[model samples]
Target: MFPIVSKLPDVGTSIFSVMTQLAQECGAINLAQGFPDYDPPLALQEALARHATTPGHHQYAPMPGLPRLREAIAHKTARVYQVPAPDPATEITVTCGATEALYAALAAVVHPGDEVVVLEPAYDLYGPAIRLQGGIPVYVPLDSPTFRINWERVRAALTPRTRLLMINSPHNPSGAVLTTEDLESLAALVADTPILILSDEVYEHMVFDGVPHRSALQHPALRERTFVLSSFGKTYHATGWKVGYCIAPPALTAELRRVHQFLTFAVSTPTQHALADALETDPAHDQQLPAFYQPKRDLFRELLAASRFELLPVLGGYFQLARYSQISTTESDVAFAQRLTRESGVAVVPVSAFYHNGHDEGLIRFCFAKQEATLRAAADRLREL
Candidate 1:
């Protein structure tokens, strides 16, 4: 074999993929990955079918995106956040998915030795993507249990080398939602600095209990400097579609597009048209997300209430974290997660997978964005524990 240098020497297969594969091999209900077992809304499926058969729609979309799609996104953003609509021509760039948006954003802005502050436990991709760009990831751990941001700790993490701060609301793994005050503190933190914000609001519509998912774009101080990313996959239950977008100021969007054009010049043309149709025809789809998902969240929680797993509060997002100390203190989270997959006939992601240093809180995360029957069956197996 040729001698090779690994960009991510310490990284291995993602826990999500590993656990999902284990679930498949074990014939277990897979709640480890954050994707619904069910299909997307019928309206969305039909739109795709309509466009897929349309002549002349298979060609490449504009480098930035389909005009109609970008316009639809801008309209949705302005309507949902009550902020001014971003210029579709200059401020939005559609990509393969939020994953690509994240990579492009980091590659565009992060130079070698620049420090990017990331809150942990973060999405598994955040650290690796930052590292691949030769940027240093400065991790600030969120408050445990609630998983809320600690602004003072974030403040302490900043240095003259800090180029960007990455944040996620309706946060992954923890389901913790950021409040308006949290955004205020963030705006104040980077007020005088040249630091940029990367706000990952993929789970924007999934907040429960009447709590709002605060976007950095909503704040005047942070809006221009923030790259707000949202996922069509997350919103439409079409993770396989791999479509998401970035909304930033024109200047920032230009930089993002410089990298984006080389990465994936244009997203799937037919998919973009379908998405545009869905957005315009079924605006209620976005509005109904909370009511649709909240019931699943509640039902899963109620079913697990009597189990040995101590369920944590899910303020937003679809994942539910449960402490398994009552079940086993001796087993590491990874071993327990694996054992549970093999023995209990259910799969989960150990919370430690999200930490840079493998910090285990004896907690495992369960994705609740599944069909009611799937959740109930998984809950039945879980209750046996």
Candidate 2:
């Protein structure tokens, strides 16, 4: 057998999976993986069961998506973002998950030797996805303690070779949400440039503290050049369902479909019907999410208040970043995480895993997107530290 060079040569088992497996092995309360411990809406489950046996949906969904699902998404976009409802038939492509949508979008826009500007301590998938398309990922660090975009730094990274800028808001691990000014900065930076934007907004519905989520679709200049990817799983508390969609202009959608046709052909048929029903039945479900999660965040923080760990502001997302330097000065973030998982019986993801060079900032990320009991139990364990 011939030895083959790995495409993502440095890639190994993801930290989420590693931490989850360790949690399982050690009987730890697992907060390392970003998923809800509770079941999705009972209505959505019943809808799935009803639709799964329906004759028309038993087979494959259309390559772009189920029309009804796309329509639901379009209506939601129009209502939420206050933009003209995109033509569902022409502008939306349902994907297996936001993960696939992001990868397909990257494959569509990036060519060999092209560059993609990535915000560091970002999602782990961005760099590998860009690299797979033979594109270079030019990293810029987000301002720490706040994880806000440093627009000047982003501007400095742009070159004529740049093909795309990827961004995530209600950003993962950090819990920072983007504001309108950030969007305006981005709009000005890419003006008249050939760069495209891949906006990963899976956590769009989870902003907190009376702040509104600023979608890329809301900015005219951004909407013209951005491929907005969102996850239904994240919204519906059904991460296992893995259903997500993309919204872009006609031309970008056309290109995305070119790659998406081969990526997964279509998302799950019955799940699409279920999600469509969920959206139609309760358009305000997303609006209720922050209220639903805020108490849990408060509880988790209150439990940890007496501990040595200092919690950062969690403006959005279910994750919390805690600086652990006071407790373990000798260990790297990775070492600290592993030792904590084994000793304290609480698992977490080191924020360094989201970086290009594993830059440790003495911070670790905990997914608070769990059941209340789960959060309480994890907090109980963590308080022992």
Candidate 3:
């Protein structure tokens, strides 16, 4: 029997897992994790059921993904980004999920002592992935109240040892989407730098209020030096399907697949077939995503308006942020989240959990990706405060 040391000693269960478990334990309306309570599109579900019985789909897909799925992704990319379609065979690799793609991307790029710059209140996975590869993570806090990036601070954070910059738009917890100006500024900043980008666009199809998602793939220079990742689960409201894809330059794709080949080898076969059919059979599902989620975001905002929680502007994505400074000035974000779950019977993630230092901003994030009944039920519990 050998004594084992933990690689991620500071890491335990994720906040999403922790809060969701607590919500279940307390019999609360679970809004802590960003997942829909609704089913995926009927077309996709039917495709899955049909494909599952098909002979070839029961086994492994291509290491790069099912070719049909890759081709469909390529077509979608060309249409949305208005850029040259990446050769599906050489540049696109289907992943287990966006999480695995992101992990594989970091493993492909980062080496010992390298630094990866991250914008905070970032997704929790970024820092740990960097650290797992023996790399340093430099945190740059997005400006409070608005969670928008400051370019000067970003510029200051980058140095010669900086190997990667991670960007998440339609950001988790805050729902901040990157603007065109932000992209142009990013392109200018990285123009001469050797740094590569891991652009997390899982929420790509979910931008709201007529604002474009400004994908890294849309900028020629940025596209050349980036690994762009997105999720079918997000597009079709089937998150448990865990199907995602990565598009990079041929060389970068080669490097990522080297890591990804060992990481998961391939995503689910039938699910890939289902997503391919979903993409090709009805492009409107992705096209109408913003419209689909905007009303729910609005509904949540409207219903929660009377509560002591201050609603933050939701530019995109399914999550909403509520400031609790008005509700309770004493408790840390973690304590408030726990207490809120226990007393109010609604669970929300603490925004501070996304920060490395646990930098409390007196904010909690609620997942509005729920049923109308669930949203109303959660609001009913919350407004009683």
Q: Which scores higher on lDDT, 1 or 3? A: 1
- Each candidate: RMSD: 0.7, 0.8, 0.9
lDDT score for residue 283 of model 3: 77
Q: Per-residue lDDT of 1-385 in model 3, one digit per residue for the tens? A: 9999988999989999999999999999999998999999888899999999999888988899999989999998899878899999999999988989999999998999999999999899999999999999999999988989899999999999999998998798788989888989999999988999999999998888888888998888899999998988788888899888899999999999999989999888988988889888897678888888999989999999999889989888899998988889999999999999999899999998999999998899999999899999999999988
State how far residue 112 of model 2 sits from its true place (Å). 0.5
Lowest summed lDDT window (length 10), candidate 3 = 278-287
CA deviation > 4 Å runs, candidate 2: none
Pick by lDDT: 1 or 2, better one: 1
- The lDDT per prediction is 0.94, 0.92, 0.91
Choose 2 or 3, whichever is better by lDDT. 2
Which ten-residue region of model 2 has the weakest summed lDDT? 375-384
Show model 3 residue runs off by greater than 4 Å.
none
RMSD of 3: 0.9
Q: What is the TM-score of each candidate against the true structure?
A: 0.99, 0.99, 0.99
lDDT of 3 at 189: 93
Tell me how many clashing residue pairs each candidate has.
0, 0, 0
